[model samples]
Target: MSHKEALPKAAFQYGVKMADGRKTRRTGVGKRDDKAKLDRELQKINQIIARRKAEAADGGGVGTPDYKRPRY
Candidate 1:
């Protein structure tokens, strides 16, 4: 039988119980949303930082690297 067709009924029963609980963590509802949003923003900032670092590495003028002096 397929794995999808072999799931235990106890799992479904637990899911029902978890859904019925107002503060059940098993459902993972509305948990850490702010942290997730912050992570997304951090990822964006890191992407921008990487782009700037690459531009600096190619001898283009955006800003001086932390370990280098300004030659201009």
Candidate 2:
């Protein structure tokens, strides 16, 4: 509640781009889907999954989100 602690806290991020592509951050997509794009997306997903798995194997698993928790 204090400004001191609140200042360090970041507000809710709306469109944050993670390791995944734009689909992971926002919905909808533009035209242009070909063999190259499909292969590119598959590669991206594979990379993300592999990275996450490696992180988990290293004793650092992904945190669980509390659905019941209120959003600011």
Q: Assess every candidate by TM-score.
A: 0.43, 0.39
Cα lDDT of model 2 by residue, 8-62, tens digit? 2233232333433545534344334566698898999998888767756875533
lDDT of 1 at 39: 94
Candidate 2: list runs displaced more than 4 Å: 1-33, 61-72
Q: Which candidate is the best by TM-score?
A: 1
Per-prediction RMSD in angstroms? 12.0, 24.3
Q: Rate the local accuracy (lDDT) of all candidates.
A: 0.73, 0.56
- Pairs clashing within candidate 1: none
* Runs with alpha carbons beyond 4 Å of true place in candidate 1: 1-31, 61-72
lDDT of 1: 0.73
